[model samples]
Target: MLRSAARSYSTKIRSAVRVPNESYIKDKKVTFDRSFPVQKRTKAWEKDGMDKGEWFKKNYAHVHARQKSERAINGDNDPFDKRSKHYERIKQEGSYKREQFRNHRSEYTRAHPLQGLKPNPLIDYVYGTNSVLSALLAKRREYFVKVSHYGPLNTQIQSLCNKNNIQVEETEKHRLNLLTNYGVHNNIVLECKPLQPPELSHLGVVNSEGSTYDKVEMDYDQSVNTRDKFMTKENKKFPLGIYLDEVVDPHNVGAIIRSAYFLGADFMILSHKNCSPLSPVVSKVSSGTMELLPIFTCAKPLQFFEKSKEEGGWTFVASHLSGSKSKTHLTLNELSGMLNELPVVLVVGNEGNGVRTNLLNRSDFTVEIPSGRNPEEARNTIDSLNVSVATALLINGFAN
Candidate 1:
């Protein structure tokens, strides 16, 4: 039995391990042979003895011509041809639509010239909860429209609107954003007439002793007493005022006004030509302080300065850099000593350019804030503070 089992195992091993066929091995070897013939490749320049660049130029034109002929024959059967045609059609359609829109816009603009071309000056939009509430309470501007708001309106705001017979409407935040020209609206906007402050001449005369002006006439619905309250005799005694010399940034204008009003400034004078307008933005940034402060417009600031110095007994103190080239210079500590000597007007200048050279020359005192760094260190670093910040420091120094 052992011999028979051995024979059967040998037979099974031989059958499982069959040898490869000689012809099949030879055929497989031939299929992978590295000695196979390869066609010689040569450039046109090599074949025709032409310049490499010229040969390539000719070859490029010939290749493109062949491709063009092939595309004409194959038409949309070629994937590239089909894709290019599809893109061309889409581009043409887009251009045609754009042209149509441009023509339509032109016609609409021609038909309605004044509607959207310019902003309406009579109506203004005031936003922010504090600003809107303040405008409603101030009653300096006429309110004939509704208050648009998003989310829950403030209780005080809703109550004021109701008391004033102004309507309140719930609106989307986007509408509020549009109304405020994307300003920081705080989700509430009020529509009202623009607040127009009276000029310095219209309000009263500036005398050497003090504000010897008559009672301000109330042209609008504003009470005469309210106007008179700001210009009282006590407030004008040794009064401190701010003169904005071509300060055109609305934000800086608003901020300076806010600081001045908070620090008990008597009045503000704005240059008529270059100063920022008392727009809604100024009111919003000022936190409605613009409504409370007494503002006067001076068309010619140099003349106003001359007149104030000669006749009004006002001292002009200009905020200057620490090492400015002004003839008269005073440190903040020095400026404090003379705050009560006479009526003072603190002149702050434009953001880019400092106080105009002429204004600096005209100023009686040019005040500068002392830097924490020494002169050498301060010269190497940021040498000056922002006009608004410097103005606040000067105002604080004078006020205290």
Candidate 2:
């Protein structure tokens, strides 16, 4: 019986084992195909019976000369080599630096905690006291993230979550803490859905020409304000919109949103390239003002503004180092005077490199807030203002 069992076991093991392919197991003999071979040009030196190594050295004499010109590198403590240790010491130091850099980078990945999204980063987590409550109250998103447990703000979010049919996990609080990087969760962290922007068909005003509104994914409460002529309002609040031309900073964008919303700006347009997305950080920094502001994104912001100028009669004014781009020394005061002429669109550019040349050319006017400095004074005194601060200033002027 034991002998029969052993035979069966051996047979089973053999069946389970995988054998390598015959081709893979065989020794590989690599050979180049001679069928497609091209004839090589024979040099005069080869015909003269020159050795290949000697021919190479003679033909590439300049390369050899460069090697001879370089200072000899010696191992440390080589007594016979009297040459200065400058280059060798430098090479050794450089090698040490390279090794140190490799180790530093290896440790960097371990210490920095990986910046981008994890496969599952809890979808999104909106934590502060106000952000948590506002996220729940806004109801702009489909449903707030369901939590197995609640922190200090549980009573507040419970009903809101239930009404929205948000799921409930009923897990412990420590998991929530880990999700937020131990932030002051206030006993609430929302793994909520993003606000789905209303479709373009449902947005924008129907122009007199009646068709040709290309759809773009935009965030803004259309029901709260409007889809069209949030541009033209009766309260003398002319359409005051802003285009962020590649403003990459989320903090800046968020602060600008808060400023724009509070200072009476209507909507915002974001360029597709070199710009930050409407992430959770933007929403958090805006203190929930992002929900209130109407944001439109366009692949070609320059073209969109141009079209608005020709068809929709919207005036796109690009804010720059100096509003000197326009032929007529156009000033902010001029924009105030021309307010009734057309809806205003202010284009704030990247922080370092103002607005792009093409965009500035498309503008109906240019605005440059003069540095409050003397003619000879260094720019350090006051070269430019923060984009958010600048936007606030412009919005305030438009609001008045």
In order, the Cα lDDT scores of the candidates are 0.75, 0.66
Error of 1 at 194 (Å): 1.4
True-structure Cα RMSD, model 1: 15.0
Model 2, 289-393: lDDT tens digits are: 877676766665655765566655677777877635547445555556444444677889998897999987787778777665674666566578898888888
Candidate 1 per-residue lDDT over residues 1-400, each given as its tens digit: 9999999898787465657789668766545346877788897698898999888888797887778788787764563567778899999999999999999898755233124335676778888877887788778885548898899989998888788889989988766766776789999888888887655432333443543432233344442422233332332346677889899999999899899988878788887778899988999999989887878776556776776676556788988775765457877876654544566789888888878999888989888787787767535667778888988999878865
Q: Candidate 1: lDDT of 158?
A: 87
Error (Å) of candidate 2 at residue 128 is 2.1
lDDT value for model 2: 0.66
Q: Which residue runs does candidate 2 get wrong by more than 4 Å? A: 1-118, 147-150, 167-178, 181-187, 196-226, 229-237, 323-329, 379-381
lDDT of candidate model 1 versus the reference: 0.75
Quote the positional error of residue 327 for candidate 1 in Å: 8.0
**Candidate 1: where are CA atoms >4 Å away?**
1-119, 201-237, 322-327, 374-381
Candidate 2 versus truth, CA RMSD in Å, comes to 21.6
For candidate 2, list the clashing residue pairs, or say none: 148-169, 148-170, 148-171, 151-187
Considering summed lDDT, which 10 consecutive residues are worst modelled in model 1?
A: 225-234
